[model samples]
Target: MDRRTLWSNGAVAHISLQDEVTAERFTDGEVRRVTYPPLASLCKSPMGNRDREILWGQSFNVLETDKGWAFGYALRDGYAGYIEAQMLAPVEAQATHRITVRQTMALSVPDLKATKAEHVALSLGSEVCVTDTDDKWATVMGAPHTLYIPASHLTPLNDKEADPVAVAERLLGTPYVWGGNSAFGIDCSGLVQIACHACGIACPGDSDQQMAQLGETLDPGTPLQRGDLLFWKGHVGWVSDPDTLLHANAHSMSVVHEPLQAAIQRIAAQGDPVLRYARLTRL
Candidate 1:
């Protein structure tokens, strides 16, 4: 699992391949399969940083072809466009992997010498690719030594064993940053977005996006449940139970759990009374 920053930007996002040789194209929607691994590199174009300037994630599906390799990818968050033959890699997806946070976690390598390297530096909301966990440390790719993080610090965003509440608590004081998905920075929407993802639900990335995904809109007076999804205009949070909701607020840098009534009052005081109401989505 060699990690490459999606762009030269400081933001480090993690993506894994489905098979040994898949193309990671410049444009998102291209699909191609290769017999070898891609050169561990970032997606760069001959044009001067044009594509790199934008913030987006592309989903590409691998397709095997008679030619040496080919790729088909959907760019711009799976909605608008597709491209082909951008880049290729030689490895496949692993059934197991650990995400990392610490600057240097140790990992055992194919070379047999234990190596210590910078694990992916996702603040809080960012994710990493871990191959396995050895005792107290997580074994990530490209490093020779196993990296250590509080077992409590990592979540199985893709695992059935993950504890959503425990994971959500790690960011108690994290500041609310728009479009932030890492602990170093996070947004109200990203807080609930990732929490829901950890629990095996596919939530849209923002408040308005999330509102559309809920099966139905409930009146604010309705009872809530633990793990219920709640939304406010331009903001969103998670319900820990009928009475408590958790969210990252501009007013509160870290995620906070408060009585639902208090939270609604707080929002109403801000002059955005519509932000006081939440539509609930039960998972």
Candidate 2:
């Protein structure tokens, strides 16, 4: 669920995490809106583990502040973390559309030739609203200005794909990251989190938390099937089929398709033994 390239200096970094910032530092009320498109990752600490993702139009409740960093809980999942104050808008904007594709760029203009750092890639399930549109491009309301994304990349929020594993499969070659949850980079739990979110299923932002909260555990002897989840001490993978596993992992440094038993043996050799397998509570 997480990221930004900003943090301020020693004026606040010198202060202890135990102390609170002056209440005056907070914007009115405590609620802030995300202005950064693509994704705003909520981290474990400032520049810490990117545990969850918030799209361009999501909101968060500010609990405290430290210089340019705001500590808060995401309104979407109530997961708490520090986000760069610059990444959020003091004013709120409602989201009406959701990005349904694996990756789509938000362009300053509708033209493909105008691509630059200004147009970063937005990941699946990130929400935005269409303010205006022509036949080929839809204008998405962005932080400082309205940006255009291809009309093909979005769907009305009410229209969602039904298969979670199929959505995960779309990210087959994304690079593995320790805590990233965007198409720009991702982690083991982040992969499942985005996959479940696309199908309108609520999922937690971490592996162990997902294991505890998501679904019913299967008996040790139960047969593996597509959509079954396998877990280790701090990692997870999805069953692509009865015999194959799909996951974003450091071992491959990317999402990969591998034999289920081979993965179990490989991880066991690395000292993290397979802990369990489970299924969606609805499945």
Candidate 3:
């Protein structure tokens, strides 16, 4: 199968597709979950930057495994890559809380200073299930182990932010990563995904999928407002105001705000024209 023909292979995932595409390959895969907070799905077995990050609780459809690399699709967005075999859980786990802020560490205990070396860094939108709790900390089930994170650092999925644009503004200087979705690093679509999901909105993990999943298309001449989604061929961003556009882009190599018209002309000059504009619908 050509990489383009592989339905689940996202741009940042492994480039090749199986020569012989068959239904049996995908159908035979078993359900698994990402136990690691930021487990990477590398294009190669050992690991490299050409990899996609798999968030905790993201579903995996593992078709095959060898030499510690499990090959399959990330069911959340159908992006196929190779996640380390050890990064998966034996059974699917329920995720109850989402990390709200940019990035935080899940420590071995509640104390941040004393347990400085005993924490796992988790990015925004990473999920966890509260297993035990106290006033200052909550013991959550983390990848391959239990972790204690600040109780205030997490919120229920339904405890949404009021302004999606405000949520996107939280990461103004975050570095851009091709397939990244966390505040530590992000991409155009990743920024949109985090911002929308924080507001209790269900947005897909990629720009094209997001365009289809978002609300009714608006005419290009329609007045832009906060939360309006601006889409290009492989990019997406949100309107922070009538004139300001917020996005995690490669040109700046970080999330930034720029004039919407400037972005349109700059992108069009590169041949990736703005495909459409969408207004988010609360469902």
Model 3 regions more than 4 Å off: 1-28, 42-51, 115-117
Over 4 Å off, model 1: 1-95, 98-133, 136-138, 143-158, 161-163, 274-282
Comparing 1 with 3 on lDDT, the higher-scoring candidate is 3
lDDT of each: 0.45, 0.77, 0.75
lDDT computed for candidate 2: 0.77
Highest TM-score among the candidates is held by which one? 2
C-alpha TM-scores of all predictions:
0.56, 0.84, 0.82
For every model shown, the clashing-pair count is: 47, 5, 2
RMSD of each: 10.2, 5.7, 4.7
Sort the predicted structures by lDDT, highest score first: 2, 3, 1
> How would you order the candidates by TM-score, starting with the best?
2, 3, 1
* Candidate number of the best lDDT: 2
TM-score of 3: 0.82
Candidate 3 C-alpha error for residue 3, in Å:
6.2
